[model samples]
Structure formats: structure tokens, C-alpha cells
Target: MDSAPIVVHPPTGSGGRRVTVRGEILGLAHSDADVVEFLRRAGLPDAEGLLDDSAWVKWRGGRAHHYEAA
Candidate 1:
């Protein structure tokens, strides 16, 4: 199977940022909005705070990603 893609967003001050890319899991995430929520629940850094400095980072040809939590 393919790994899930990671989306990074800069901080927004509210502590929650934005998910740049969506994941694979439908219940977990498959769209931008769903990805954002998934990260939030995953205990990852708040997306709102990372919105201004985050973005959709992907490999050259790979869909999966490894994000450095800020």
C-alpha cells in the first residue's frame, strides 16, 4: 500500500493550523478538511498555529510524507 501524505501549515495563533494535503483513510482523512481534523485528533501540533508557515510538502514522486512537528 501507499503511505499517507502530510500537509503542513503555518501558525495562526489560535494554536491550530491547517493541513496542506489530505491523507488516505476515509474515516481518518481523504480530503483537505478531513486531514486537518485527523492531525488534530492525532495529537499533532495544532494546525491553526502552523497555517502561516506550513504547506503541502510531498516527495518528488511519492505520495507519503514525514512531517517535522513544530
Candidate 2:
């Protein structure tokens, strides 16, 4: 399988997930909009659309849209 370019790491104690693109750490995201904004700042176009595209984003240690740690 092809690896995704963006990775949304598991939520931290503060309920924020770490967003990374191409191995570069973007920032902590508390919501989908935050993720999109991070991507936008990283010079990515159509970042909102990328959130749902599995080929573009890989959500690890939790489900997509889930920010609270279990």
C-alpha cells in the first residue's frame, strides 16, 4: 500500500494530535480545521479535501476526527 504524505498522530493528554507532513512536524491540531490550517501554512492546496483522503492523510493510534485519548 502507498504511504500517506500527512500523518495525524494519536491524541495527547491535552486532546491535541500532532500533525506532520512528509516527516516534517507541522503542529498540534485540536480539530479538523486546525489540521487543514496547518496544511495550508505548509503550502498545501485543498487541505480540507485532504482530510478525507486516505492517500493523503494517515490517522494513527486513533480514528479520524477523534481527538480525545482513550
Best by TM-score: 2
lDDT of 1 by residue, 1-70 (tens): 1133454344334333344345532232333455446656756557444433424343222232323222
Minimum summed lDDT over a 10-residue window in model 1 is located at 60-69
Residue-wise lDDT of candidate 2 within 1-70, one digit each (tens)? 3299999999998788999988889999999999999999999868998898999999988789998865
Measure candidate 1: CA RMSD.
11.6
Candidate 1 error regions (>4 Å): 1-28, 48-70
Give the Cα lDDT of each candidate: 0.40, 0.90
lDDT of 2 at 38: 95
Give all candidate RMSDs, comma-separated: 11.6, 1.8
User: Pairs clashing in candidate 2?
Assistant: none
